[model samples]
Target: MSYPKDFLLNLYKTMVRIRNFEIMAEKLFLEGELPGFIHLYIGEEAIATGVIADLRKDDFITSTHRGHGHMIAKGANINRMMAELYGRTTGYCKGKGGSMHIADFSIGVLGANGVVGGGLPIAVGAGLGIKMKKTDQVVVAFFGDGASNTGAFHESLNFASIYKLPVIFVVENNKFASTATTKETTSIENISDRAVGYGIPGITIDGNDVITIYETAKEMIKRAREDGGPSLIEAKTYRIKGHFVGDPELYRDKKEVEEFWLNEPIRKFEKKLVEEKMLNETEKRKIWEDAQKEIEEAVTFAKESPVPNNEDALTDLFVNDSGYDY
Candidate 1:
């Protein structure tokens, strides 16, 4: 697939933005500026950026606990996201939902679930909604390798396949489900192999390669929009960090972790772009600087934002007109 120069540059920029955002989040978390446990998407930027690039603004996406990249790639405002992390009132969820629970319905972000496989069924439901409405929009469910083992994953895929629902199950197989490696828990060599049971197309690719991810997602998304049944894409990627902030990471070797960082997707893609003469060093530097500035400004915004009022805790918590008991 031939990629336009501008499109390629934009992809690079998105990856950089995600990388820098996560880096800043990590720094803030360590400095006690941000609250809650954060599962940084430092190494998985390419998967979200590439998959979301093919999605329409109105198309729905269900995200995992490690979902900052997905939200950013889907065009969520970083300023509000930062405020949410800071537990400020100006956040996407009015500071009620932290990093793991951010949602922007205007951009079709269904919400990032804190549960391991929570988003699978939600994605299926959204797909059903789209089908019933007779819309061409599709839903993308972004989950980790650990989520594939959940009953929700199996049940949702089965349901979607039987009904020919327009949903794509994207498995961000980052090798580990928290502290446990997939090799320790999963029996199959490839998570994509499970798709055969559902009678849908399943394929595994280098999740770190943005170009490959973009092309593969484009095909599956196009197929889904054209009334094709659900598909499973297992992205074979690695998480450079521990499961969450402050994790001891004793389960994996330090040497192995260092090696993975050496081949970090963002750096690899930048090298490829420069080699292909699609991006110059000056442009790359400018991109990094711009991303850093944006993140700095977001942090400032979050810091200056007000905390949620104590009496308003239950404001948006309930759907009923009667409201909830305090």
Candidate 2:
């Protein structure tokens, strides 16, 4: 369970980057600088950061709708993410794919999906590619608790398990999927427990604790790389924000929301670091201050960057149609 000082520091930095990025994205959304719906990755930062931190640079990942944290943790540039949200030409998707679809294939980020549980199959396909090519690259698929009920989730895992594909399915069980609490929709106590049917090893960990998440993720990642087959990791965490920007969150109790913030994953993580003498309060503050500065610079870049031209509107499309192609 011992990690090198550099690895630990990078983990801390990734989590901080995700947290600050979400906060800044919210601000930009409220200001009308960004378009479309955004599902903030507020409390679920540790799961993405922990899982992807163990991955190789050439390894692949597919993300869910609430994917900013995963992208940032997976080495996505903050400026491009901000520009994507801004729908500028400098975006990862060239101003076409906004919040739900920012992708950087060069770094092995397959793409972020707007559909729930959509990334599962893509990740499985990537695993298939890896196995065929005899590469050490593994694919990590991230989704929410609600996505577990979808057919794609079950099918992809089954295929991965049957073929012994090199993929890790990470379920960020953030209590509620959108507006409905997971308890109301499903009877299972632990989502990872469902992996039994698929014949894959399943383990649940405190998604709030970065160290705990890192430990479990490292094991699963290593297992996959060694061709041991795919594993399902269900991270028990909470979502601190409403499902999307401008959501009043009438479905959740106000007190419950307040409680989650008081015991937020990032805050809890900082407490653990200080208690273990891994980091002090002053050091934590410095970390946060630096993250804030990085976020500010990203925002500035987004604002200063020019929007995509009207003539280029028809360009960058995957398909070509005669008259419609501008």
Candidate 3:
């Protein structure tokens, strides 16, 4: 349980960054400043922050719709991410792909998928390539409780297991698939239990505890990089926000959300840090202040960036087909 002081501080900063970004994003989306539907990673910040902390820069991650946290943890450019939300030309996809599809291959963020469970196969493919190239890079595929029920999830796990691919299947069970609760949808008690069928090691942990998440991910990622094959981790967390910004949220009781708010990951982690004397009121305030400044700069950059040119719509749409003056 002993962690370097700097590492623990970095984790806290990362989680703060994610929380700030999601809160600002939600505000923007509600104010009609953002163009597309954004799934906020508000309560689930710890899972991404902890899981991606153990990954190398060259390691790959396939993200779900609620993926800003993953990219932030992986060190994606914040300004470009904001630009993408604003549909500006400086975005990762040049304004073509918004919240759901922002991808930066250079950083090993394959893409943020709109389709549930879409990232699983992509993770498998990346793992297969890493295997073919004889590299030690591992792939971490992120999905939700709903996606865990999809056929792609099952098939990808089976294929990755058989090939002994370096892939980590992380299921962020926020307890709801859109409007449906996990109890109403999923069959098993724990999503990780399904790994038994795929013959991969699986475990469930308290997703809100950043330390626990980081340690679990460290072991699993180390296993994959060492050619021990795929594994599954089900992180039990909650979705503090509605599925998307502006969702009516009629499905859940306000009292329940209020209760979950008291147990949100950031607050829990902050309390731990404070008790450990790693953080204090002033330090915590500074972290939040810094995140706010960074997010504000990104918003300014996004607002000032140009929109994609209409005439160049077809450009970069393909690779080397006898280009017709696109």
TM-score of 2: 0.95
lDDT of 2 by residue, 1-326 (tens): 36566677678888898999999999878998778888899988889988887888899999989999999988999999998999988889988899999899999999999999999999999999999999888999999999999999999989999999999999999998888999998779999998999999999888888888888988989999999999999999888899998889888898997887887777777776666678877877898999999999998998899998887776655555535535
Q: For each predicted model, how many residue pairs clash, with residues at least 3 apart or on different chains?
A: 0, 0, 0
* lDDT pick, better of 2 and 3: 3
To one decimal, what is the Cα RMSD in angstroms of model 2 from the true structure? 1.8
On the 0 to 100 scale, the lDDT of residue 264 in model 3 is: 90
lDDT of 1: 0.94
The residue-by-residue lDDT of candidate 3 on 47-155, one tens digit each, is 9999999999999999999999999999999999999999999998899889999889999999999999999999999999999999999999999999999999999
TM-score per prediction, in order, is: 0.98, 0.95, 0.98
lDDT of each: 0.94, 0.89, 0.94
Q: Put the candidates in TM-score order, highest first.
A: 1, 3, 2
Off by over 4 Å in 3: 322-326
Over 4 Å off in model 2, which ranges? 319-326
lDDT of 1 by residue, 150-241 (tens): 99999999999999999999999999999999999998989999999999999999999998998999999999999987999999889999
- Winner on TM-score between 1 and 2 is 1
Whichever of 2 and 3 has more TM-score, that candidate is: 3
